[model samples]
Target: MSINAKSADHSPIDEDAEQLARLGYTYEKQFKREMSFWGNVSLGFTYLSPVVGVYTLFASSLGLGGPPMIWSFLIVGVGQFFVALVFGEIVSNYPVAGGIYPWARRLWGRKWGWMTGWVYLIALLTTIAGVAYGAGTFLDALVGAEASTASTIVCAIVMILLATGINLGGTKLLNKVAMLGLIAELSGALVVGIWLLVVARQHDLSVLFNSFGAGGGSNYFIAFAAAALIGIYQYYGFEACGDVAEEVPNPGIRIPKAMRMTIYIGGFAATFVCLSLILAVPDYAAVISGQDTDPVGTVLSGAFGAVGYRVVLGIVLISFVSCVMSLQAAASRLSYSMARDRMLPASKLLAHFQEKRHVPPYSLLLACVVPILVILGSIVSPDALVVIVSFAALGIYLGFQLVVLAALRARLKGWKPSGAFQLGKWGVPVNIAALTWGVLGITNMVWPRTPDSPWFVNYLVLLSAVAVVGVGLIYLFAKKPYTHSDAPAADAVPPSGSNRSVAENAQSHHVENYL
Candidate 1:
């Protein structure tokens, strides 16, 4: 049971060890071990909840109608396929702690890489706020707690604190907690979806195709585009799997496989949810006019009654909590890795680890703190949170777009993966398509409406632009550069001395506080 004992059980470096030896620290790796393949898949699915998928389906139905919204998923899928392919290449080649940011840095340059990382971090943090905000609304609706800002903000802070605590134990605990949450959520969604589809008669497919304003919009494409954004939202967190390269066993193969499986499973689950909602329009108007509080539960209550509705609401809360875990894990690790490389401030503190838990404790604390502050700040201005959500979504698109472009740029530069999960010859084309689609999405986010415009989406554009530029400036001046030597080889470092960089002994630095 001794920390240094290299026996099969005590060794920190193992197929399942959550805190791997390769992680630099005098602290022995003592957290829970890595997940089994099935465990990983389940965790990923939970983080990417299908309940949200149905929510998106209804949103799209309102704007673009059911048929067009489905088409939007297909369209976004194709675009994301390219990005995924490109990610496949980079991850396969250099699966490490820092993912897209490092990939961008390696393929592009230090300046650009930092820019990518900074924007991605901002986006992620912003999205975390959105999730917390949404979860607060759901919590209020399901339990009928005091619906005041005080209650919502406290609830959000508690959720973030819980996620941080789970992650402070390292990846294994995070995965296990996340898996359990996802299972509860997904099971509830599956039940609702199947029940709805079975009980209701199929609607006219052609009617959905032709209904221009099914949700009350005039233009079909605009409505579909808006709704499509919702469907795509459910698939957003899969990229987090790659961010944990330092912990994933045989990351070269495993990370890519996990990424692919995450998308496939998440996509399939989402599609099922979308289909069920489309078929089970027990009350389409009610679903579309969904409130910030317990919208999905409201729809379920109408269809399945109070008992059934409560169960679904419970599942939705589980899903939200699971998502919070996933985001916290990804965001904190990103901070740890970035700070470890001197890319963020106070590297020493953010990168510190607890020997018993074998985790970046400071990073977790800081991450939890900032988001709570953000939530509290939201109490003063509700609309500000909406702007934050849009900004965060835009940040993901911007960062990923560069990563996709980098993948293409790398391929064009003649770089290739030396392992499994190749996108074959289709890699380059797929990446290009992903870039184009991602860009289009970012554009929509930026200019959702115009001042003189008919629809009220112009402010979205202005807000997104301000967010991008504002965040970009911080990266340009504040963050440090990542060197070529900073790019650690995939699986190059072994257990005991694994964390040693090409430059020197792995420096004792603190991780960032990004929750």
Candidate 2:
């Protein structure tokens, strides 16, 4: 277990360096350890923002599973708690800036780590496109008729640029914005849910168990399966804190705590807000019949009136901007961490951290530019965001499963977690449960929502996911990028901008980690 040290000479970064050595590696400690526990919490929470997620995804869940879709909040939340537990244990042992990549490398091997990072990086990029597109759609709706394809595309690009700019300003500014976002998300979601539920609700609590027969069957099993996406997608972002562990103090302990905290805050918030919106939905017969497709807008407008609905929309917009900001931050860190190992394209440039700004400028640029192009694609095709969001969920779930499966493999090989947060007698059982939940969840996300539709229409999510990873593998073998050796000879390479060998001088007691 990691503990707080009182000696003035003992900084958190020093302990961090020692931990890296124990894992058979060296980190030059270029990034600032400027993130607080709350800042980490804000990043994770806003990344999983219930207000933004519920506001955007509630319609699909309602349209497919009717009121019974509300049950998925609890079911997905419980399943994800097991995933979080597994992640918390891994993070406590192998905390690193890239989260799953470095953890998988330390647990399994280099190829495993690279592939994990590959899928995760794509997931983050697509999620940026998805979140920004959702925000743009909402903004257009709020503008009422001035909204056009051009306007939505423009809105998404502008939001993406804003996030990139905010990230470039360094960790302090990022944390400031994170705190602002947390306040907006928590206050807005809770107030909106309570006010609507208490004052203008239309259905009884029992309505939540009714499916309304969306798929034309005695049981709406298919409808429930499709509706599960809303719940599954909302909860996967709790690991953002772990991705930026290099920037947090005492990450061995703190990152684990942050991961669980994110789940607690996000799970309850998503469930409460989802329930409130569903109960408060007006004109339920029309909504169930597909006449009123916007249950969120309907509920808010009915409860708060038209003008007040716009005010709530504005708050939800804050959550969206914050969500993308945290996503870009996490994604850039993954790229920066992997590139620093000379493991990815343009490794030199992507690995270079701006000493003055204390940020990875090139990696941040990659994160921003790719999402911009994705938004442009959305401009060409009106329904592009739907497919993009599906792919986003599929990519994330697959990436997570790889790490979880790696953990189970390690456990089977008699590996024990040396961290302070070991699961003890429950480790094997928990690992099994985590892997089981992951496979089940991934299958749900990738399975065709419209199984009988045209191949392109029904299987776009599956085909896109397979294409991404399959192409990535082909490129990997064709290029045969050398993953730098696990542990460089201690006497071989010198530290960047230093006279001493990096491995031999790995633990310097004097200088700050700001090399």
Candidate 3:
């Protein structure tokens, strides 16, 4: 357990650090190692905040595919669960600060790892803008604001600034509010779900499969897939558990459990709220046809009245604020982790942890500033934000699945899966499933289907993604930033055609190298 940190050989942080050292890199003694078990779990849960996830996109999902989108949640949730299992195995064995970068470097190599962190960090920032923007909608509804583009953007800025302040207060403040946010989320889900289910079950249970002819084109599946994006967005953030892997206690055991629990709890909450609101949607046709004022808003107002609905929105607001706080923390940690490896500009400054604050000061600042700027531009052309978020989802999935792919490659070539939690015989199959699911998910998300308009606008997501990567590559090669020596033994190629025991590899390797 990496609790309040101890010696380089004793405490959980030491345990985690020892694992880091064996991976050909030294652990930087910076963070306070102060997050508790619940605090760490809250880290993932809040990042994947079900209230924020479900409520943010609830109306859109209903409009796109009606009630059947719930099935999309189930599919993505299950597929994402398989991915989470792979992550659990990784975190159990590695348990380091820079979640994907270190894991990928160990499984693949430095270049792959750098690309993984680069994509994932930017994705996180894009999502921060999306989530903060989402919060603005609910806040606007609660406050009876005009809900204009300007008002919504301002509301988002307010929430972002508030969350930024809380994040800057450091993890201690983050943890306390995160737990409270979890409570608010759980209670809100329960109260909202049960009340709507009991008092407002207007539709039959079978409506879950009803597309209601909302499918946009000739292909019904196309519309269903489009709506699935909502759930797809909800499920990916659970991997934040691995992102902040080093800060928690008993991370070998705790981190994996926290990861799984995030899916279990977040999944249940998201689906429950989704189901409750769907059944209570009153007139599905009206909602899908834009005749109703949004099924989610309708259900909340019907069940609790306007005042009571605003009360619920208040809880959802907490969930949103808390979600932003957690996302910022996770994003900063990723930045710090990558910067620690000297992969980014101003690596020294970005990687410097504020010892007194127990935070990555510069990383935290960047985390806030970039998103704020993006949000500002989003205010200008909301479509720009949409392209950013669409690609963010794609980028995150690609980064995460790349690690899974690397692990699968290693597993096939004599790398044994060993951790406090091991998949054993199930490892190969699970890894394969994760990769398959990832490819499908990424394809669906990044596919260029904007209907009408020019090729550039239609393929904006894919185009933007390729452009960013292209630019990043140019920057990478131009700067030649990866010049630092990376603990030389790390890249030592094994003897040609030599067959080494998994046990032997595990030993020289950091898996058993730490032990």
Candidate 4:
């Protein structure tokens, strides 16, 4: 039996365990000592991928080149940081695997939490598909292979399966693999970026700063706004660290620190890469015009020749694949956490962890299978990846907004968590600011692009809206909320008496696992 399941005979199954049984599952604390702070941070940071840097090419294509693109990235990065802080404060205090879902419930109430959880869950799943599909596209570019919808779909499935296999090996293995991949990704990006900057040192850096009117045809603000949508996406996925807070030791301290590191490091790295790619462009028009294939690769091929181009392509592929793996790890933990809470159907199966592996085998399997199908099925339309990614972003934005608002309200009502991290006096204003920015981003993303808009990319405002509503409805009627004491096998002891946060207890069993 897993170390956690073995613990069942020694101690009384807590109220939480009882609740888990209602959903047809048994809670197993299977993942412990599996990830360090840096490893967890790396998982979240890798998701940005080349997607953020490549976003600049699209920005340029839409006519919002020059200073505007750089400024847009800066603006989005800072704005998103506020949201991260809100997450950090709560996650550190709770450090539970349910993450946004449990935080929402604690701060708001059961009904709102249930609704928000579904949206967060679906968004996370779709985000996995979007990142995996992008990995396939980058791999295709590296191999000089033509990627049709069918080919991309098949590649996505293959990549997802590989990622799942890695995760099934347990969090320790997953963290090690993720750390290695992260180093390669960052190292490769830096090598190319620095090399390009050094070679182009004599070029007029001012030219890179000059703003070009949206291709001379679209609205300047709207163009910049569109670029901001792309820019803002780069700053996300930092919260993935919190979803597996239970697996990390000293989670109250480590989880918050890890989250802060991800936000600051990821934000700076994304901005640096975006700027470096733009400055490396010998001819912006040529780079922007080649979106039919790989715009970033086109620029690299011209600027550094075939070898340099191939190297960049290879790095992009590796980074994207790493991102897919990281997403699977996070998504599976989220599903497992929710299932253990009796909030999802088939909870027993979905939440089960293997004793010898100390891994959520079923959850990992589900996470991998769902994304492959999503990537394959969604590849038929033009700009399928962009639409899906944006659609996924909307869900994340909503979840973040809700959590921030909930936290603010809870604090105002005198709810103070005695924990390792607390915002003190700055919490309310920061949360308010975060909420404003989130609302603006959602509205801007949903706003349609006009024929005269600088960014010509199609928006999936309607589809994204439909998805959020659909998820909310499903939660309203189908998902059931459970009391902490409802589960049969869990120690239902309150956090105060147990000296363990819900997340720590849920994930503490893996520490003794080596088999």
Q: Judged by TM-score relative to the true structure, which candidate is superior, 3 or 4?
A: 3
State every prediction's TM-score relative to the real structure: 0.82, 0.91, 0.91, 0.83
Candidate 2: tens digits of C-alpha lDDT, residues 51-163: 88788888878888888887887888888888888888888766667888776766666677778888899989999988887787789767775667788778888999999
The list of candidate 1 runs beyond 4 A from truth reads: 1-33, 56-67, 200-207, 215-218, 283-298, 450-457, 478-515
Across 1-515, the per-residue lDDT of candidate 3 in tens digits comes to: 32223566596556555555554556445555567777777888888888887877888878888898998878998899888888888777667776877778767667777777888888889888888877777877888986777776787778777887887777678778878888888898899899999998898888886688887555878888888988888886667777767667567677777778888888888899999988888788887887885678878888899889999999998888888888888889899988877889889999887767777878888878888888888767888777777667777888888889988887776666556677778888999999999999988876665667798887777887897777778877787655653622212223347565322343342222110
- lDDT (0 to 1) per candidate: 0.63, 0.79, 0.77, 0.67
Superposition-based RMSD of candidate 3 using all C-alpha atoms, in angstroms: 3.6
Sorted by TM-score (best first), the order is 3, 2, 4, 1
Per-residue lDDT of candidate 4, residues 1-515 (tens digit): 22234354543223224323332343455455568878888887776554434543444433444445667667888788888878877775556676787678656666666666777887778887877675656667667888777777777788788888888888788888878877887787677778767774324557545554443565566666766665766777778888877667666566767777777777766666766766765555543344333445655776678777777777776677788787777778777777776667787899787887787899888888777666765746546555556667788788888887787776665555444566667778888888899888888767776656545344465576576778677656664454432432212223343454343344333221010
Candidate RMSDs in order: 7.2, 6.0, 3.6, 6.9
| lDDT score at residue 412, model 2, on the 0-100 scale | 69
Candidate 4 global CA lDDT score:
0.67
What TM-score does model 1 achieve against the real structure? 0.82
Model 1, span 394-473: residue lDDT tens = 77778888787766666665554443456666767777788888878776655453347645356774556576767677
Worst 10 residues of 3 by lDDT: 506-515
Worst 10 residues of 1 by lDDT: 506-515
Best by lDDT: 2
